[model samples]
Target: MAKKKKKTVAEDDLSAEDLGVVPEEKKKKTTAKKKTSKKKTTTKKKTTKKSSKKSDFIQSSCNVGLVGHVDHGKTTLVKALSGTWTEKYADEINRGITIKLGYAEAAVMQCPKCNRVIAEALANLLRKSKKDPKGHCPDCGEKLAFKRRISFVDAPGHEILMATMLSGASLMDGAVLLVAANEDCPQPQTREHLAALEIAKIENIIIVQNKVDSVGKERAIEHYNQIKSFVKGTIAENAPIIPTSAIFQANVDKISELIEEIIPSPDFEDLNEEDFLFNVARSFDINRPGISIDDLAGGVMGGSIISGQISVGDQVEIRPGLKNPDSGKYKPVITTVKSIYEGKHSLETARPGGLIAIGTELDPSNTRTDQLIGNVVGTPETLPEVKNTVEIETHLLEKVLGAEEDISVKPIAKNELIMIVVGTSLSAGVVSKIGKHNSVSLQLKRPICALGGSIVALSRRIHNRFRLIGYGYLAE
Candidate 1:
């Protein structure tokens, strides 16, 4: 009868105790693993939230300027990025020199899973003839429905076009310095541009050593070394030099990545809707009455708003001249945004970093180039004084001046004049004082704004025309 007793299900299945396994210990280990995994999941969620907030602040909006020596593929690189020809003029393409400052618009997106920044995808999406209204992340397979508007200014690089280049760079937050990889070193214009950038106080620069396909790896490396030597002790000394071929579309993706890293995002919180500043580069009257259009608007002055909001009837100010005519002079002009255009479409209100055209009581013809226009416009802060004493950091061209020599010590007598170009304004000034330290001072023949830390160009006043002499940095 005892042998016939039925075995329990737990005993038939081999209980932990019978198998010499410790049930209490096994249960404790399993519980520990569950708790650890739960903590890990919670930590990961918190990290993701923090990362999202940072991204929102850093990628709100961005602006990049294209600069370098002539024929260094500035326009080509821009076209490659946006897939739209920025320089459409036949003469400009044929002459191999950008005649004027050009502009184009695009958007940037980010990945969901990997959270990587993406460019050119928006340009590609916009290129489609059909309204593909949706976007996806290139890195992760997740959907990227958000968009950030971006603006690109294509600046000319020729020495003769220095004024145009300065105008373009003055408005940009970042610069793309394109150096041809085939050339042994940057040309004279390249040096001139570097000086101009220094004068503008532009700190962020991305160097693109283009034309790598033509030169191949060996020569490209050689040219790259030359670039390194050329940029020594300059703001661009440690700038990332990306070797690319715009014609071949090689390393084109890297351009966007570099831009995303260098350019700072617009500060949306401190921005104002009506407080706008639009520098007038090109202005003309339209067929419509009481309305004018600025083809190439200069520096846009307004607070950044990332939430996609702007409205019409916003009051703005317009400053007609570059150097302040009066110490505290501002011409307040009220205008409503007659139309807002983003990339070729019209919108009632434009998000930040998008091109906007406003219709106002101010005549476009009256708005001259180099003028600043904005809402709540006040006299621009007085630029550094143009004095008789000039302190400069200079580089001599053609062995005419020595780097270590104080050329100004043998003072040019009174009425000795030289050319000065800062930002978009160019004028002549006479040597007023020459100090013991390679420092020389000039009292501008015509009153012009010469800010401290500005780069000043010295030219021989021959035939009453300014001839290229040398370059110097303004000092306190």
Candidate 2:
């Protein structure tokens, strides 16, 4: 019997073979790099590894959301932190705002000289903005070393993109709500984004007073008061507010330090390994135009694992999947996990926490253009039941969120079509029956495979836009 070869990826290179881009010479070069990296880390003074493919590397331990109003420096802050830009879509680039959910990962680095786990984003900011180009410790000026990693989910903050933001929130373990110091505190989307986080039940929150470079200390102090007033009695009332300048890379150390302190990763060590469930945040067909059929790569899905672990060879099923053309009914798609990725880094096994991409054995066409968004993936027989209807124990807010002026939320009316966000899934549901105890039955336009007791965000079409109204829990 032949032993199975362990495949690895270089930190700087994407999984070339996974994307069908590996030439024979490139494969040998990659193998040589892998061999060299093992010895390379050994030579380093426990400070830095030029290659993340080294055995000592670890993936991001949690997903932190970079969320706020449009043009409020969410992307700028992500770039300041991770050194990776999230805007890739043509429309997003032209519009200069996040439309689809964006993702990036950064390592929490410690300075070997300081012997303290200093803020890595601070190191990243210094690397990008300072004379040393290579990142170093802010304290002792020594080379920074890897400690842990954190993934960032950059969600759109436009008024019309509330559903998209809610969908992104489902993947977050914590969130950083950006409020521009130059603008008035509690902008419409700022209020709504915080409410959305509350609906999603994210307790680890950080409020970033971004763009502080454009404001005076007096104005900044007033805005700080407004921020304090705005968050009073809310879930984020106690969330530390860090005044920042995302454009100039100021106070990122504070942000990174608070993230480490507030957002502790879930201790999934005791979680049952059999209960494997993953939410599909984004899916793509990575094959470029005019690729040969023989070398075409399979579909890829990016998301975070909610529970258990997934292996490279595991068979996974996507539920509430593609609609059957003949009957217009949804059907599940089963595929094998061909490869897994944390950014460009490949992994043989994955557990819950960081955002991951699973390369699957499926046709690229089916997964292109995010056709598989809002689908739940799990083992064939282990996935939760698909539901066309759900009963939610509704909790209505006092007023509609994301509105210019406060608008009182009307009670759920019969036959009222509303937008519902469950995990990464978003669908329109008609209020079919309103029973006692605010139990509302919704006939979903699209079927969703979600577990019971999941938190669902509700929105109403106000002025031709879906404004967040409140949240509810799937009734038992």
Candidate 3:
């Protein structure tokens, strides 16, 4: 009796219900394992959904031009902000200057804080945030999210390329005037670029004091003051000044924050409904020499849409288009927009206020070398009338810019030939008639698309090269 019968092997393996005695420890372990498996399955499903969501975070695109004197870090600042060196030309890289208009785009992101308090139980099971590249916040172990995307047009800041700067200015909703902290404020190009901004009426500006890392705090402060004074009484008088070291990416985040705050996308509710007006800045033959007829690409025009919207396959009429040698009269070039591209992003349609590249069906011979730079791409029969004779309400500046001597801006004399820039189009205009104070009518050598109140940049040859003298508005 003391030596009880050996417990049967079946009895030891009995189920809790069969044994009449509950196996509480085993039951708890089983429940815990099931819960963990469920949690893992739920987490994997959630992560799959979140990762599938496309990043259409860029709400609306705005062009912000970076303008300043040569060697002021305009290109460097662009590289810092967008991680791209805009100068793609060989000569530009060799010369260490932005020769043509450079372009880059970047997205500004922010950390996504944990909305739910990190409970001890849930903390270990939480997923990483999309906003924080590290997946988890170091402080509270949260995630991050994307904020906005901004496109920067890095314009050449050289004195000789003021025309290019002005052309780029026409596409900007705002501008960044870079002033190197190591150099004196109000460098010639800095002043000149600021003045050009004023003429273009670009009110939103951010003044960047770059190269601060190369100087001490005292020197940086001095440069800041110089910048404040230089901008005082000018268009950028109220603009914010952000000190940064573009070479080292110091305080570069501040610049991005400022851009998002100051250059908010424009309200295009009304403008988008109006007729389209695309200013052709640069056009080229993208086809290579060896390409066969079947594989040859069409002509590509790169520029910004000043107004309205254009979609793929839209029939557009280019005004003052390819001048037909046989017919002296200007003939409109009719073509369909084969494709539209904004930066590296492709789009089916393009709206006002962002740079776009349009591929068209046309003769490549007509587009190479920027021969069609100043043309307007618009709806057929809906574009503004092309004019060979333009009457302007001129307002001459007090002095000529980019000149060795501070020459006073003189009144337009009859028969004097001068350079004219309207939108992105450039032409030579001969003053045929002079009217009252700051009024003149000119006969243009190249026809241009002129609206009733379009602004025109006026320039004259002062020391061999043409210099910006003043701006004018198209007469009614």
Candidate 4:
């Protein structure tokens, strides 16, 4: 097949793309992006009953991460797997790098004809629209069966956004590590991200040897060897490596198949509802400009539930939530869950798995511009208490990562400042005391709400930018 006549679908006003869809035309020296109008979710007046019924079904999706070095095709792979690109910020779009944590949801569909699970490439973002109608197999015109929806958490690969990536990893159930065949294996972020995944304790990983379209056969094979060598004896040592040209939507079905086979959804039913927790990664005021107060919707909280379940009308608390500007003190915000959404579909109940949004009864101003991000949401009276300081058990790696040169990790010194990340929350703290058992007490600059025994990612400022030094857990 020739590439010259192919037409790649643009991000806006689209549902999904299929193998039946064409790839974007490419130039040897440049990559092209087509921007469409702002996304809207209004369904046609002639909407069918089946579509409405499909929309009403309640199903939770698991998270799958797209992580690796910058310019290595993580976003492109997301575009291939899910028709919409994840980068929405003007800076991210203009710079061609994911600066914030970008997310897009794609459903894994199985072809009835071949029984092959494949990419859900035709649907537009569930985040942007309320509809996620299924698509047909590109192989056969026969309709495809819906397997499961997996949220693609597109972590920023730039060294500066390492903290952002770590926060996003807290939501992921599994991840696909993207490595471009055109570059050397284990680029700085490639190594750092792998370490972060290890710290996050994510064991399910798939290596995507991307850009085979740009590299020759010999070069591609050599890069494969490099990837294998890089992951040897690491958490991803047994992970499968899938070669693909995400730019051309090649071998995406194989990636989808593995996501279904290897990355099963969390056993939500087995999780005790008594241990309820939600990690807030984003917050928003969905009201448009010029909307009257009576017509304005309540504020929204976006994240994944870590355990148990939540529902409409349930009373919940947002901890370390709103800050009192005058006194600079933080307190929990208790509110009712007015609505729950997985993508565009409104749900009566939200469980642990993929990304979701909880519509609360608070003023839209409170949630505007992610004011409530990095906070925890849970049962009102049972929520963890907000803390201004904490003690943690530590685990340090021998060498520092994300640096140009290898350097030994230095011991934590008293009074030194460090960044600590836990379940989408990030805080800077001063080391107040160092215990004999690799533990340190920290006086936090910003208050945080997390359960005991939660994983903590520790980073030290290096050359004015923080680099991950090690990880630890909150004391029980």
- Quick one: how many clashes does candidate 1 have? 13
Residue 141 CA displacement from its true place in model 4, Å: 3.4
Q: Sorted on lDDT, highest at the top, how do the candidates line up?
A: 2, 4, 3, 1
* Pairs in steric clash, model 4: 15-122, 15-123, 15-124, 16-121, 16-122, 16-123, 17-121, 17-122
lDDT of 2 by residue, 1-476 (tens): 12222132222123222222222233345567766777755646332454444455587789999888999999988888887778776677789998888888888877777665645655745654467646677666788877778999999988888888999999999999999988898899999999988888899999999888998999999999999999999999999999998877778877887888899887878763658999998777776454457666688887889888898899999999889889989989889998888876767789888988888888867877778889999977899889999999999999999989779999999999989999999999999999999889999989998888999999999988888998998875
Off by over 4 Å in 2: 1-54, 119-121, 127-135, 272-274
Using lDDT, give the best candidate's number: 2
Q: What is the Å distance of residue 187 in model 2 from its true position?
A: 0.6
Of models 1 and 4, which has the larger lDDT?
4
Cα deviation in Å at residue 316, candidate 1?
Answer: 4.1
- Provide the global lDDT of candidate 1 against the true structure: 0.55
Q: Where is the poorest 10-residue window by lDDT in model 1?
A: 11-20
- RMSD to the true structure for each prediction, in A, is 23.4, 6.8, 19.5, 10.2
Model 2: lDDT of residue 252 = 81
Clash totals, every prediction: 13, 0, 5, 8
Local accuracy of candidate 1 as per-residue lDDT tens digits, 102-219: 6665566666666656564433533334444346554444565454656677888766666667666655667888898877576766776776576567788999989998876788
Pairwise TM-score winner, candidates 1 and 4: 4
Cα RMSD, model 2:
6.8
How far off is residue 60 in model 1, in Å?
Answer: 7.8
* Model 4 weakest lDDT span, ten residues long: 15-24
- Error of model 4, residue 240, in angstroms: 0.9
lDDT of 3 by residue, 76-139 (tens): 7777666667776657778999887777766554546643322121122233444543434334
